[model samples]
Target: MQIPFIDLKTQYETYKEEINKEVLNVLSSTQFIMGPQVTKLEENLAKYTGAKYAFACSSGTDSLLLALMAIDVQPGDEIITTPFTFIATAETIALLKAKPVFVDIDEATYNIDPKLIEAKITPKTKAIMPVSLYGQTADMDAINAIAKKHNLVVIEDACQSFGAEYKGKKSCNLSTIGCTSFFPSKPLGCYGDGGAVFCNDDALGAKLKSLLNHGQGKRYEHKYIGINGRLDALQAAILNVKMNHFEAECKKRIEVGSRYSKLLEGANVITPTIMSDRNSMYAQYSIRVKNREAMIQKLNDAGVPTAVHYPIPLHLQEALSYLGYKKGDFPISEQIGTEIMSLPMSPFLTESQQDFIVNAIKA
Candidate 1:
């Protein structure tokens, strides 16, 4: 039997009729830009995430850029973030002509180690962006307290963690600004590229809205330089429909993740950890294993598909050569970069399929 890494087709099959109807409604209305659908989605996401404001944007990358723009990131300013994440997290900071200070990650959560954050702070530091990697919320309470002491902004890159929670608070609401993705495979996904930024601060929210739409405070009135980063009404409508089933999907993902952890117990793999204070949405069921490349080959030969979330940390990537980072700068991140591999994961994943994957790894 063959198994796909992320079976969006199964999920689509289950929600096809409703999704089609919603798409047809958008087509019929012909309000394809930021229309009623986008407004409704923004409202629903704000309520769901417990954030006072939400602005849907073009993509997860755009969400990070918009957050930086909302905060008026200045050139030569520094933003401290984890190196063990998608390049977008750090790339956005560099795009603004700001510096991205790389920090190591906790071996357990694959998140920025807050204990190491204070030493990295400087007068040039403007913000701290901690990514909620692999659908788990990072230690935001600690991160926030540190930011407060240093008087810095905190942006949560919740790209893979839409429904995740930490200490009774949701991921997006835990930071000064929270950004999430709706890429087709995320917990709350749409058909195409889409994302949102969440915040409780009103003035900042207003500025974010302005920054997303050519700096408009009113109709066609430009106030500052901005980019066209608006979310399409079609993606909004799809996300609204998906949001209707999001809670159920999250529950299913939890069940699948739990089973994987239990079955892989005491095997040659290090299971993903669910910290005592947080809940993960399990966007990708990644595990640390020895000889990850060989194991992937073994699993693939047995028809079990696998992937690596990231093979290279940003500090060591060619894109960030100017950062002056070498291979040994962030050892933990570099180690994780080599050992981590993602198994096939989705809310629609079946137990038999998981069993097959596990057995293949054992074999």
Candidate 2:
């Protein structure tokens, strides 16, 4: 039997009618741009995440960029972030001509070590952008306390942790500004690229809205330089339908992740550690193994598909070499990058499928 990683097709089959009807409604209305659905989605997202406001953007990259622009990140400014996250987290800072100040990650959570943040901050440090890697939130309270002491902004890269919670609050609403992706493989995804920015600061929220719409405060009025970052109405409509069932889906994801850990216990794998203060959405269900490549090959031979959420940390990438980072700069990130591997994961995965995957790993 063949196992699939992230069974989107099966999920679509389950929700075909609801998803198809929403797409058809968009086509029928022909309001393909900023239609009513977009506003409705933003409202629903804000309510769901408990963020005072939410602004949809074209992609997760744009969501990060818009957050930086809204917070007035300037050239030569520095933004502190983990080196282990996806490049977009640091790429946006570099795009603004601001510097990305790399910090090491905690071993357990694989998130930026808040204790090390103080040493990285300088007068030019403008923000702290911690990623909630693999669906669990960083220690946001500790990160926030440091940011508060330094008077810096905090932009949470919540792309992989949209439905996850931290200390009773949602991931997106736990920081000064939060960004999340709606890529096809994400927990709550659309047919194509999409993302959203969330904020509790009213002024920053309004600024983010303007920045997403070509800096227009009103029609034909350019308030500040911005990008065309608006989310498509079609994507918005699709997301609204997903929102109806997202809570239940998230709960199921937690259950699935727990089962994976329980089954893998005492095996030659290091299962993901979910902090007691928070719950994960289990976006990838990554496991750490010394011989990742061999394990991947063995799993593939058994018809079990696997993937690496990130094979290389951002600091070592060719795109960011100008940052002058060397391999030894972040030993933990480099080491983990070599060992982390993702298994088949989704709310729709069945008990038999999970058993098959686990047995393949053990064998």
Candidate 3:
């Protein structure tokens, strides 16, 4: 009676034939590293997302790192971001020895509050890295305006919102630089770690390509200090297969997410909020409840699994303690950290499974 949290297996079964074929092709070709599929996948992704260029990378974390490195994020530079997100959001900033300035999130969307961003900006600020958390984008129009005024770069940490749109624009295309993950659990995932950087600027695009491939302007020429962030051929092959069905899957994700909101209506829990100008990918159908521990236990007992997207705000984390932030610094992120719980979410979730999960919540 136990239900899977992500249901990746069900999705795999649906595309079994195509996925197997692609894997076998990659295996047989033995072009495991940067095979033909890598370029093909990048081209497919660029066309799909409407980005001028797409640079495939090793992982989502590397995608963010590459974006930062491409823009020359030096030590002592400051980057503003939400504290409620996964550690990778801030960890990348710290890894470059840059300070990740914390900003509070909006209560309704669980995203960085643009109204609070301007107050945090200073001369040392290099970029405003806003995360499109929980498969929805932050207020990019406002965020972009702020970044433009200060002449700072805007990096959309869209790792969780690959299929999402904001103000009629795709997530990765909504900022100066956008990054996404192709981790198997993401909305559009590969069999293993893979990610891409999306950008419209030609110079930055060229720089990103070189940065991901050990700064190779050509085969052996080192241009900038870069990392081993290339996306290999096998993952590219798997993603190419997935690309054929991604649009349909995104539609199904919306259907299932909408159904969940309807079913959970007046269930005394706060459901996700999608703004009018954009649509979410619903990477997580998370709900807010006052009794989180009790609710998680009840759901698990009913054979329904639940998870917290995050348990601690980044500013309050011990690893980031040297930033000199405390418990009350980001109250909204801290409060939501305690209450937000993700339910089973996937394009393939059936109505009956949703009904069962809702019943468990009501009980």
Candidate 4:
């Protein structure tokens, strides 16, 4: 049997009728951009995440951009972030003509290490953007304490962790400004590209709304310099339907992750670690293994598909070489880049399929 990674097809089939109706409604209205569906989704997202306000945008990357713009990130302004995450985490900071200061990650959690952040702070520091890697939030309490001491802003990159919880609070609402993606495979996703920024501050929420619409306070009136980052009505409509079942899906994901850990015990691999203080959505059940390439080949031959969350850390990527980082700069990130491999993980994955995959790994 061919086991697929991230089975969105099963989810689509489950909600076909509702999703189809919503899409058709948007098409009939011809309000493809910022339609009523977008407003409704934004409101629902805010309520779901416990944020006072939410602004839907074109993609997760743009959500980060909007957060930076609202926080007034200027040229040479430094935003402290992790190098082990997707490039978009650092790319957004650089796009605003600001610098992204790299921080090492915790080996077990794979999230930014709060202990290393204080050393990176400088007079030019503007914000701390910590990615909630693999659906688990970083050490937000420690990071927030550091940020508070420095009077710096905190942006939680919850793109991979939309429905996750940190210390009894939702991941996206754990910081000053939280951004998440609704890309097709995210914990909460739409049919296509979509994202949102959440904030408790009413003034900042208003600023984010203005920035999402080409910086417009009113129609044809441009305010702060912004980009066309509004979420399409069609995508919002899709997300609205998906949001209805998100909580149930999250519960299933936790079960899948827990089972994987139990089944893989004593196996020659390191399963992901979820802290007791927080619950993960288990966006990707990644593992660290020796002889990763050979293991990947074995899984492929067995028809159990796999993927790598990242093969290279951003600090070592050629694009950011000018940042002057070298091989040993972030040893943990560099090591994980070579060893980490993601197994097929989804709420829809069946017990039989999981057993097959695990048995193949042991082979």
Candidate 5:
């Protein structure tokens, strides 16, 4: 049996009618830029996340860029983040001609080690950006405390963790500024690229709204430098439809993830771990293995597809070489860069398909 890594087909089958109707409504209206749908989505998202405001954007990358712009990120300013995350986490910092201070990740959770954060802070450190890698939030309480002590802004890169919770709080609500992606494969995704920024600070929220629109607080009046980062109206309408079933889908994702952990107990792989006080939305049920490449090859041969969450650490990427980071800088992230592999995970994955995947890996 061929087991797809993510069963988008099954998910679509469940929400076909609603999604189609929403898409058609957008096509018919043709108010295709930032319209009523985007406005409604922002309101709903803010309420759902318990944030004072939410700003929709073209993509998660744009959300981060806009967040940095709102905070006046300048050249030579330092933004500390984990080396184990997607390039966007570091790229956004670098794009503003700022410095990205690489922090090592915790071996168990594969997230930034907060204990190591204080030692990296300096007067030039403008912000601390911690990524919620693989749908599990990093230790936000600890990270926030450190940020407070150093007077640094905190931006939670919640791209893979929109519905996830840490302690009793949601992912985006725990930080000064939170950003999430709506890439097609994400847990809370639209058909195309989309993203949102979350913040409880009213002033910051208003500033973010302006920053995403070329710093225009009012039409034809530009206040500060910004970008054309508005979310597509069609994408917003699509997301609104998706949100109607989001809570239910998140519950199903939890159940599906639990089942995978239970069934893969004896398999030759290191299953993901959940922090005691946290809950993951399981954006991608990733695992660490002895020989990831060989396991990938075996799974491929058996028609059970698998993928790596990331193959290289951001600090080591050629684009960031000017940052002068060497291979041994972050031992844990480098180790993870070599072994982490993601399995099929979605709200609609069937037990039979999951079993086929597990059996293939075990065999």
Candidate 6:
């Protein structure tokens, strides 16, 4: 039966009429760059995430960069983050000539261990950037407490967790500044590369807005150095349509994730463990298996496609080798790097397809 991972085509079909109308509207307006759609999307995003303001940007990486720039992260400054996350989290810090201090992750949640953050704090520590890995937020209360004690900023990499919640609050609004992606496969996505920065502080929000538009306090006036990071009006128009159904989609994702856990209860793999106070969007529905290579081969032979969220931890990547990290630096992250595998996950996945995938795994 050939199962697919992330059935975006099916989702597209479901929203085809609305999506087409939005796209056509943008095309007809010809105000493609930061037009009315972008403003409307930013307002909707801010309201959805409970943030006071939102700044739309070109991509998630740029969103992070804009957040850091707003907080005035200077060269040689240190920012604590997990090594198990996507490279963009650390790459943005490095791009500013700042140092990314690697912290080990919790084995169960696959998030940066908040307990270990204190030991890493130095006078040079400027901020704490925690990634909401796999659609669940990190322990924000504890991380914020630590940041408060140190007088450091906190930036949440909410790229995979746009609709998720932490302690009854939305993920992106849980910290000082939140950055999220609108990639085609994200929980809330646009047709092309798109992202946004969210913050409750009005002053910081204005700074983020200025930073996203070539550091312009006004048109043609560059105040601080910035990048060309404006989200296209077309992408914003597409996302506006997607946002209308985001809540329902999130509910469906939770239901599908719960079913996967129930079906795989007796299986030899370790399913995700969500915290009691938070709800995950189930971006990937990943699992940890003892023999991942064999399991992937078996799943492939059975026509049940699988994928790995990350094969290498960021600390060990060649690009960041100059950070002087070794394999044993983050034991938990290194261990999970070799064992984690993602299953076919999407809000549109059917029960029959899930049954087939689970039966193949059990075999």
Q: In order, how many clashes per candidate? A: 0, 0, 0, 0, 0, 0
Greater lDDT among 2 and 4 belongs to 4
What are the runs in model 1 whose C-alpha is more than 4 Å off?
none
CA deviation > 4 Å runs, candidate 3 = none
- The TM-score of candidate 1 is 0.99
Better of 2 and 5 by lDDT: 2
- Each candidate structure's TM-score, on Cα atoms with residue i matched to residue i, is 0.99, 0.99, 0.99, 0.99, 0.98, 0.99
Q: Tens digit of lDDT per residue, candidate 6, span 1-363?
A: 957798989999999999999999999999999979999998998899889988899999999999999999999999999999899999999999999999999998999999999999999999999999999999999999999999999999999999999988998999999999999888888878999999999889878888888889989998878889999998999899988999999999999999999999999999999999998998889999989999999999999989998889999999999999998989999999999999999999999999999999999
Q: What lDDT tens digits, residue by residue, belong to model 4 across residues 1-363? A: 978898999999999999999999999999999979988998999899899999999999999999999999999999999999999999999998899999999999999999999999999999999999999999999999999999999999999999999889998999999999999888998878889999999899889999989889999998888899999999999999988998999999999999999999999999999999998998899999989999999999999999998889999999999899999999999999999999999999999999999999988
- Candidate 6 ranges with C-alpha deviation above 4 Å: none
Q: Which consecutive 10 residues in model 4 have the weakest lDDT in total?
A: 185-194
- The CA lDDT at 228 in model 4 is 94
CA RMSD (A), model 5: 0.9
Better of 1 and 3 by lDDT: 1
Evaluate residue 325 in candidate 3 and report its C-alpha lDDT on the 0 to 100 scale.
Answer: 94
Q: What lDDT tens digits, residue by residue, belong to model 2 across residues 1-363?
A: 867799889888988899899999999999998979999999999999988999989999999999999989999999999999888999999999999999999999899999899999999999999999999999999999998998999999999999999989998999899999999889999989999999988899889999999999999999999999999999999999999989989999999999999999988999999999999998889999999999999999999999997889989999999999998999999999999999999999999999999999999
Residue-wise C-alpha lDDT for candidate 5, range 24-137, written one tens digit per residue: 898999889888999999999998999999999999999889888888999999999998989999999999999999999999898899999999998999999999999999
Model 3 earns a TM-score of 0.99
Candidate 2 yields a Cα-based lDDT of 0.93
Whole-model Cα lDDT of every candidate shown, in order: 0.93, 0.93, 0.93, 0.94, 0.91, 0.94
- In the order shown, the candidates' Cα RMSDs to the true structure are 0.7, 0.7, 0.8, 0.7, 0.9, 0.7
Lowest summed lDDT window (length 10), candidate 6: 2-11
